[model samples]
Target chain A: MEQNIIVSVDVVLFTLSEGQLKIVLLRRERDPYAGQLALPGGYIHADKDRDSLASAERVLLNKTGLVSPYLEQLYTFSGGVRDPRGWSLSVAYYALVHESLLVPDAELRFELWPVAAVPDLPFDHNRIVDHAAKRLRDKSTYTSLPCHLLPELFTLTELQQTYEHILGVALDKSVFRRKLPELDFLEAVPDAIRQGKHRPAQLYRLRPDRRLTIFDKTV
Target chain B: MEQNIIVSVDVVLFTLSEGQLKIVLLRRERDPYAGQLALPGGYIHADKDRDSLASAERVLLNKTGLVSPYLEQLYTFSGGVRDPRGWSLSVAYYALVHESLLVPDAELRFELWPVAAVPDLPFDHNRIVDHAAKRLRDKSTYTSLPCHLLPELFTLTELQQTYEHILGVALDKSVFRRKLPELDFLEAVPDAIRQGKHRPAQLYRLRPDRRLTIFDKTV
Candidate 1:
């Protein structure tokens, strides 16, 4: 049996900015990879932490001073020699947050790098980020766009644009609108409208009853 | 930082028998939860094991003489005190195999239990099994039905029955058959046929080019 095996949680926090997907990375504070950029994460507290997800949440709050609106357990990477310190395993997580949440925070100790243009990251973080990005794109095709990435209220066109940006594809406006019926989580904001170039577009926000999961039914 | 944390890999291996979905379990051989039924697992061997998945595959081959046809990473379990040995984490995996692979080995130490009627499993094994069962059913609805669970060659009726058993629902025969064209994984076995009571049903096998993944396009 392997001795001295430590468990940690690494998070691939994702958001959209300038019409592109981005991930948040923090500079490592300790040796073994100090000064190198890596995903925001820390060791799980055996006595204090309730679970791996909680540990990841703690890492997020400590590094960025913001809370993720949507987070899920991604793959666990314990393949190669990721840690310079003996054998260790990291339970990775992927989270979604609105770009606006972090854009105004000048005190954040992390940098948001475009998903495609990410430089070399320490450990297996680059591989972890790649997996999470693929997961987000795959889910976006079937599930409703992550509302947390947008403002409190948005128009249908704006929602469609978000999906297009994440999926890296162009969707027909009419076809995309037709699928809105299946997304029962969205609720029309009464009397609220977004003035567009041609006319005022109706505004909608995710219903309070609906959780982050936009659709449960199979696509 | 939490010290003395151990990481292990637990596998929920699934197969079909007697038209029912079943999972394999082995009796524990150690203390803390000795003599109780539990998922086959062991501590990660950092010295020899290449990765967590490799540890899972090693455990499968060591405990059960047969190798799995399909295996996927499921959720990781790290809740309350699941182990008396202190804080530990299990990187769980779910595998699929044909029942015929194990039915011939009467000396195997594992027992097959229906997914719905799983008895009390020690150390969060039950929760892990529950999550794997739900994952199998969910994937069965949209994915390729895990053809590895069936013989190399099979009839459409036989394949549909496998789907029905895993999903616990009767699929419309015509509708189910009509969807096969989209699967593209199943290739007709040339000149092979299964003699039925009324007529002979054509046999089909997975195409060499197509891997296990059946569906790539959005539903």
Candidate 2:
């Protein structure tokens, strides 16, 4: 009866593509629900891994040939007969990476699906994705979390669009621009400008030092 | 090698007493640093429990003889050889209760210690307590979490005191009063006034419907 809880780590990796927030999902290779869609995850290697975060990173590196710039512990789903093997617990995680960061790998195939159109996933992955998406949007309101969803160099217009995409709402252009300076992480690139249909907009990149910054308070 | 990961739930129950935030702790009875101080917790009974939250509620009830008004999933601490009994994971939870509600249990002695003065605890319980305290303070800034630390019936001044105690800072009375109306949860109890040293101050209580209200934005 003791030590009966099996532990695993699942990563809900999110990225933006074609102006839509998408989740990277992989097909499960083994049984319980073979060939079904599921988050990239694997059993926690107690002997080799340092912690759940490390286990999650290892799983992502092994399964998707990509490394996320930002990964946070989302939640731990346990109990209930979710796993056919036995009663199991999964330390779930959510990671954010620019879609362009994904490197093609011949051994693994990953597909990006719009979060709104996600199909019924294996186990409770659909629930995990939904929870993670909510967290991302919630944190985006105050923190620099949305910056991770965009490339290193981007125009202010592109940054605003990324936020709008994740939030699923069109924000007021002036209000968003006014709040930009308060974020204090965007450093204007002197000569960089993106020629949009209307005019050239100044480009900015997240200051290297602010890559891991969480704003002290909501603006 | 399967089903080797041990899973448990730990509860960090906090309450206000003597105008200070205190945590409820229990002394261990067996081999795990026997007789040492630790957070109230127990192994998840897979056969009887529904999930980690249910397990936490059960443990709190059986050990402390009281139910928490607010219980949240704080964080999950896993991996590391913290547990001498092999690889184990504990889903840590933090709860809030009013001191008046605790009915002393002779068999199960529970003591409330100031959060800042907590002594070294057994296992990773010390780290769990610290993390939960930080989360409480962080959430207090945006949510109506300060309400949990106060009794069901309290004055506006008492409510402000509770917030000040948790935040460890002084607030402007007029500014606080101006923001009170926007909370939308405080209802004045007519004819119920506390005759203080100077004058009678009106009494108030959390509106029954908004007891669980979490403000949409920070004050």
Candidate 3:
């Protein structure tokens, strides 16, 4: 009876690097398709906590030696035939890490690939990444999830550029600025940050307490 | 190594009934929490298809005796000890079905519960449902996914009510009407649908050629 159940967790670590959305993938060291690039993941422990999110967190930390960042469930892959050996169930999670915060250790061996240029991943991971990418693009238009990937304080132009990169389209600057007041969840700082060669733009931070509900907003 | 792989699939089926959002659930028939209410799911087959989505589609049809409808990958649940028996992974999918399409067969036994008053579900399915509900609410704001739950030709009032029921809020009539045209995905039909108490309202349908894209007009 114990042999019938197999649980695993896969993590899709996302970050913005060099103006592109990148995902962290590992080259498997063990057999059963060793050296294939795939998401960092492993089997669940019977003695661990029952909560799926906590289990995903534990597996991620063990594999990459990284603590929690911005993690959320992506989707579950339960195919009668996903595993060659037997029936294995996998719960996939997507995480966003600020590019500045990523510190890869020597012991951890993985490569970060741009989402647009990633080759085929092993065991249906490509599909998982595709779904998460689409969700990220869709959610950014209506929710505050995208802010989690950015620095605490950012210029409106920087934020808009992030949106453009993910959505793969140029937006109207005038209309975009006109819609900012309706967000209500962004608060401008009294001081502005300056960059080279252009005028300093106002910096804004996410107002968690404001809790903007865009349930009816035009997406 | 043989003991490490375990996989499963869970499905969240959504339908509109009597102008309310409802979910399909099943009463457990076996041990490890017999008689408990849970999502209809089971172990993945090892030799069927390697794709997670295909696996989900196969399991969904087997358990519910239903064919394809509007389905999307929702989220994955992988906790180390979610299953008391052993390690198990679960991939979840969300499906939207029109009430008229559901064929209640004797082979499939389950109950439809209103989203507002769902009872305790087995494992982490309760949390899964909550996440799916939130996604449905948020997706309705920008995409045409919610239209899958409505008839081919529906009134604007019906569309608004569908949004209201899923969002759990009363939207302003004028504001919602104004936003519909901005979407550019809905086309008004020449015919009208009559409600019992109100004047005949114009009906509308989603444009087949206009695919949903996550792009800002200004960027």
Candidate 4:
């Protein structure tokens, strides 16, 4: 028996801006949900390469005019009734891009909102964003993923702020400092860096040899 | 605007048995392609809850004739051409259950195979399995998830075995043991227990305060 087939890709782009976490969203200019804020996405081609990662890159570049960055497959959305159109399946991906790196050209119309102020998204995209947010929060607790969203050689305070923003909790300064040394994944740089009106804080970069492992360590 | 609507859910049931990591899979009884080993799943009903987690539980319980154990949303599969019948999306969930607890009845014919022995699964299941396996491996490195598949108060050897099985690696016993003390998640019971012909091994249990966090501690 023949079956109708539909496939699409959506992106949840994350960035750190003005000491807060933000997400990239767009307003659709065409039909089928025009003017609604939605995660940028599109239909998949029949002859497209089977690599979902590559497909995500293609769609994101086409829609937002952004190129290669740290992208990972987030999840899939396939519910019979999720779409008003025919059978549609979406392969959703989450990307970490520096805010300064985002260059919105003429092709795309979008805005970046601090995660806390994000409005209602289109087509279950809110759920997708929530999932990515949870992953980001949980991952930061154990992995070096937060580093991707930060500037190179950031201060301990800056790093901690990113965690606090994602986790939504005030962390103990001393306790957080004690935990950093255990994370052999980070390497201290030669010079301390100053952020306006504050004492220069120690700068550190992600250790190259340190691969992210989801192993628990005593705090 | 009339799009064919199709939806499905696939389960990745994981268990630890005889010091090996195994997955539960079903042999297709009837289909456009029958007599093949595949994940147990089916279409979602419109009348059902919109929560994917709830829908996954309902579909998994129906297919396996088993109650819910520990289930986590893995990923969503939506590649337009993944389903030949039409555009279909499959929400996949990965679950961990004690092998002894699963009593698959006659209706749902399935076999438990080591992750290594699993054949090329149908559809994008191979990809799904790959993703779930990676998550399991990564999570096992630092979380209390492995303990969920083991009996209460298991020996360090058994715990190590579970790690080896999931990670597909022979970790140094001494190093592995040393690392345990660093992980506040495991607590040793006051009483030591002997199993088989070996000397009494320290029995350990999961610490209630130390829950599994889905983050990679880059050490």
Best by lDDT: 2
Deviation (Å) of A47 in candidate 3: 3.6
lDDT of 4 by residue, B1-219 (tens): 334445567889898876678888888777745888888777655455454555677776777766755687776665556776655567788888788777767776678878888898778777778778988988788778888888777888888888888899999999998998877788888866666777767788888677543221110
Error at B165, model 1, angstroms: 0.5
Question: What are the per-residue Cα lDDT tens digits for candidate 2 across A136-211?
Answer: 9998987778889888889888899999999999999999999988999889998998887888888889888878
Return the TM-scores of chain A for each candidate in numbered order.
Answer: 0.90, 0.93, 0.89, 0.88
Interface RMSD score of each model: 4.7, 5.2, 6.7, 8.0
Per-residue lDDT for A79-174 in model 3, tens only? 455666566666677887767767678887777899999898777688778878987897788776677668888988888878777788898888
lDDT of 3 at B217: 11
Write the residue-wise lDDT of candidate 3 on B78-138 in tens digits.
Answer: 5455676655566677888788877667977777899998998778788878878987887
TM values, all candidates? 0.93, 0.94, 0.75, 0.70
Q: lDDT (CA) for every model shown?
A: 0.81, 0.83, 0.74, 0.74
lDDT of 4 at A197: 73
On a 0 to 1 TM-score scale, where does candidate 4 land against the true structure?
0.70
Q: What ordering of candidates by lDDT runs from best to worst?
A: 2, 1, 3, 4
Individual DockQ of the candidates?
0.50, 0.51, 0.37, 0.18
Model 2 quality (TM-score): 0.94
